[model samples]
Target: MGIETYLVVTDLLCSREFPAEDGRSDLGIAGPGYHTAELATSRGTRVADASMREEVMERFHEEREALAGTLTEWWGEPSHMGLQTIRLRTATEEIPEPWARLSHLMGDVYVWEARQCGRWIVLGVADRDPTDEIQLLLTATETDPP
Candidate 1:
């Protein structure tokens, strides 16, 4: 019903510990370095009130920052990628742009890579009004499966 935001992480051996409700079993398509886990949540569960849009956005920012901090602590600084880069890469691969339709709901989408550990982490936040529902996803993987 709503756009889902997926937080994807590649290459870190903790998939067994990920909760089952988070779609860890679905195991979406893997890219180059693929060993991953995913977690998802709906926007309604995040912001119950329509008037709290700003607060909800703030929370998203905090969550993203915390995730980045944790990853950095565990794996060190990350190589960052932007939406444009992702778009270009997808276009080059002839794959449909995953974020095209949900672009309006997105505030910031960050893709971070820890090459030394062969890991990739993606954090996408929905900054739209609370009335519009969205899904948040978190994933960890090794290489992109071809």
Candidate 2:
């Protein structure tokens, strides 16, 4: 995925027409959140060779930085929060919507919280399962859930 993924998702969010369906097309992705309460617009693209995990991770970081740059322009600086510890509890615990769901896949995430609007925007990369995909996902949720 590229920066366009971020742009498209942001457009979807701004329009309040989040991909309510689950599937992937070209660079567009929408699906159910790992936790049902949080509906994340997600996309998963498979790696051509699982052995290229290192290369994929390097690319994931590069893409993350690019997207983070755009996000900083829109949401201001973000807090780079660690999730390694949190990932431990995901299996035996129910932490938080996006966290609980994301923890299972990544060690950290970039979070931008627009507290005044009650929303949090998250960007993360996942390569935990080399056989699966090197994913870059943009997701959001309410700061205070109902």
Candidate 3:
């Protein structure tokens, strides 16, 4: 299995525990969502408010809750080391503009929270073998008029 890579790209982080859908403590939530807008945070910086539409905020909350559920199921403990690879796939070729905006807002929130407080992450497996090509070649038929 190939390990997926995910780098933390946020300034502040949340360390407190939050309720997942199941009302569990093992599952925690963090986001740069409502924190500083500045790209980088060092010794001294101001935290900015996260911006989003009402509907978008609602969706973000739902997504965070769902994520919490998955986290609770996978790991009893929530920490960054647990997350090395995460999968993100969609039928859509590219994320819609609105969704992209929401993603940015949510991502920032989570990251900020994580930086402020410790965070937990989940790993994922990626397909790295040439099985697809091999299967395609194997399926080719050499016999004629069988």
- Give Cα-based local distance difference scores for all models: 0.45, 0.61, 0.24
lDDT of 2 by residue, 1-146 (tens): 34775676655553343345556533334344321111222234353554456666777778788988998888899988877778776667667555665777767778887554446777777656655666776666553221
**TM of each candidate vs. truth:** 0.50, 0.69, 0.22
Residue 58, model 2: lDDT of: 79
The top-ranked prediction according to TM-score is 2
Give the lDDT of residue 57 in candidate 3.
36
State which candidate, 2 or 3, has the greater TM-score.
Answer: 2
For candidate 1, write residues 1-146 as lDDT tens digits: 11122223333333333342323245543333232323333445454765565565566566666666666675667654344444444545643223432234454555555565454555556555456644343434443311
Expressed as tens digits, the lDDT of each residue in 42-86 for candidate 3 is 121122223323333344345444444443443454332211112
Q: What is the lDDT of residue 129 in candidate 1?
A: 41
The residue ranges of model 1 lying beyond 4 angstroms of the native Cα positions read 1-50, 84-93, 96-107, 115-117, 128-131, 134-136, 141-146
Question: Residue 83, candidate 3: how far off, in angstroms?
Answer: 18
Locate the minimum summed-lDDT window of 10 residues in model 3: 132-141
Q: Give the Cα RMSD of candidate 1.
A: 7.6
Clashes of each: 27, 0, 23
Q: After superposition, how far is residue 79 of candidate 1 from its true place, in Å?
A: 3.5
